[model samples]
Target: MTEHPHVNIKRYRLIRTIVIVWMSVIVFAAFLLNIPRINILEHTARNLYFHVPMWFTMMGAVGVSAWHSVQVLRGGSIISDIRAAQAARVGAWFGVLGLATGIVWARFTWYVGSDIWWNFDPRQTMAALQLLIYGAYFVLRSALDDPEKRARLSAAYNLLAFSTVPFLLYVLPRQMASLHPGADGNPAFSEMTDPVMKLVFYPAVIGFIGLFWLLYTQRVRMSWLAYRIQGESKY
Candidate 1:
């Protein structure tokens, strides 16, 4: 196997350090920063820094996966295949975190007095369905034995799954009556957001996306190393 030219170890380490510090500051400010609080979204409003960014990071990861999947389909390179799979895996975890955070956030804010942890809110439901689609991509990979064939087939399935992300997370949810912000003609978080919150929100999004890239790159490196150690050059 050829040395990976694209991954710069020194640069990656530097950026990883930066991301660690950046996210630490973002988290500290998210909880400690004073901002105007709305009626229902009092203290829980701090979740905006964490929850919303998780989805943004997930979407960014999915985009990276789709891009590498295209590379796999175009050139059938094993390295690209490895990247696509790792990107999707990391991205899917972010999606799961986003859903979990949303659930906890809603439990306190929306369904505070009720025993409902989940009420099938349209946005939440669609997000869950979207994750299941990605889940199938992994299962499909496991079912196939040939590396090249698995890469090809799973890349195709991954593209199909990526196609539904926008609709499931954005379009369809906005069309339905939902408790989530930016649904059913409701104002988006951006529209009515305080400028103070945006200070932390934007950086949080960038930090989480950087985190996804870090994790995805690490997995790809490990996978490539494993293949090399096993005497499999074609991967």
Candidate 2:
């Protein structure tokens, strides 16, 4: 068995403190900072801070997961396997949040009168499909019995999953007619967006991605410990 890897507890704690403080400030600014409201978005505009950041965080997490998966394939270490699995798990949660928030924002802003919760908007549809791809990755991992076989197989599968992200989330959505900002040749969250919103929007993205890192690292540490103590990696 490989020697258990050491996680930098000091670094984790420091980043944990910073993420907490940073996100606290972001939450305050997201609600309190006033700006010229658009006709439809009005107060729901604030959802931009929360909703968009979730997707950003998810994408960041996916990238981290995929990077470690690459390391797993190259070296076949349980360390990279644990990191990849936890990062993808946490990342999927963020994707779910992003989808939920988008649905709520649409209910108020896009579908005000009708009782329509989901209209199958192109971006929304693609986003859901993207989550399912990652979902399969997890299920694929759980079905395998051997750690080395699971690690190698899942790492290859993970690379395939990550490859779908850009096209599903960005490219395909832009090609279809949809209620989302970037549809049919339009840029996502760019045109008609207020400059002041960008101030909070950018930081919110950073904070949430930082938050993903914190959660991902915590899971990595736990998984690493479990592997050390139990002699196998779970999940």
Candidate 3:
């Protein structure tokens, strides 16, 4: 029942306010900002503001999770263990959102003509598989009774799970024939995408990552508080 030193009321309020305003402005620009549209993409191109950021935020969250997992192994602190677990959990939630949004975007843009919501695109398939790997980490933690053992085991699983993210999301899918951008022979933003769009794109990525940190930190605080009160490790 040790207190985590990172939790603070004033700092939390400040970050919450900043994230709220950042997201508000991003939403406004996502709809209002004018950007070039291609033939198939058309208006749905605006989804770049929402869809792309989910994955980027997920990446940021996973990276944070892995860092904390390393701390768990090195520092051997229960709070570090809590942080590592919560971060991975929140990161996985973002991954789900990213996959869901990608499906919807593809449904409209890539599979617009037929009754095909999913055609087993390699990017989609790989991303889903990546999520399943993280899901198993949660299930594995639940099965273990010892707190220290669970922390060490879960941290190892998280490290292995994170290693697959880049290959699944970026490398393996691109090696095959896929409808997603960044694939071989497909149109990429480097040449086709407008510069003005990037003005919004990069900030959207940062804003969503910050939003993930806010949510992650809140959960860490809650899990810590619950652990303190319940005297159990399974928060």
Give the per-residue lDDT digits (tens) of candidate 1, residues 21-47. 998999899988899979989988889
* Candidates ranked by lDDT: 2, 1, 3
lDDT of each: 0.89, 0.90, 0.88
Cα TM-score per model: 0.95, 0.95, 0.95
Q: State residue 171's C-alpha deviation in candidate 3, in Å.
A: 1.2
TM-score of 1: 0.95
Clashes of 3: 0
Task: Give every collision pair in model 2.
Answer: none
- Model 2: residue 4 alpha-carbon error in angstroms: 8.5
User: For candidate 2, lDDT tens digit of each residue in 68-141?
Assistant: 99999998678889989999999999999999989989998889889789998898999999999999999999
Residue-level lDDT for 15 in candidate 1: 89
Model 1 residue 71 distance off true place after TM-score fit, in angstroms: 0.7
- Deviation in angstroms for 195 in model 2? 1.0
